[model samples]
Target: MDKYPYTPGHRGIETSIAAAIDINPKLGRLQRVSEAAIRDAGTQGLTADELAAKLGQDRCSIQPRTSELKRLGIIIDSGLRRSNWTGKSAIVWIIAPMLNSGESPSQ
Candidate 1:
């Protein structure tokens, strides 16, 4: 996958993208690692920060992978938010409903 630097450059976006591109070969592995972590969290789900801590990775490394998974529809927002260390709220993510727990039954 190819990546371009984030526009409206401020401080380190260029270097960040460059590093990401340099690790392009590992993108799949990163995504899988992230996906598994989120899936394993089950119904409780996880925010990016929680995933990072669980995986022992930095937020920059884990957040982008989760964003990619979300964009690809592998996961969805669980309609919940949790506070981060700084007390700012972040979205909780879960496996896309159709992909988890089979179908609901009223029969």
Candidate 2:
């Protein structure tokens, strides 16, 4: 990832992240990590920056995966937003509706 300073509520930042993930599908690990965190986060949901903090990663690292996971139908917006590192409100993500069981269906 290029070293770009994150500007709160900037459209460019999001666009760049999307572009990177689109180009590199090897970011699968991040997707799994993000999904697990979002599920573990439970109904309260967590913003990208909050998930990053919980995982001890950079916001850029967590944000892109969340975007990808949302696209993959693994997660969804909780219809909530909260302050991020820049003190700007950001959407919180929860696990997708189908994954609510906590345990896999086979378990």
Q: Give the winner by lDDT.
A: 1
lDDT of candidate 1 over 8-69, digit per residue (tens): 11236888658766667767877889889898999899999999999998887778777778
For model 1, name the residue pairs that clash.
none
Off by over 4 Å in 2: 1-26, 101-107
- Candidate 2 lDDT over 3-86, as tens digits, reads 322111234687865666453544656667877888888999989988999888888667877766776567889999999878
Per-candidate TM-score against the hidden true structure: 0.78, 0.70
Count clashing residue pairs in model 1.
0
**How much lDDT does candidate 1 score?**
0.77
Q: What is residue 11's positional error in candidate 2, in angstroms?
A: 12
The 10 consecutive residues of candidate 1 with the worst lDDT sum are 1-10
For all candidates in order, the CA lDDT equals: 0.77, 0.73
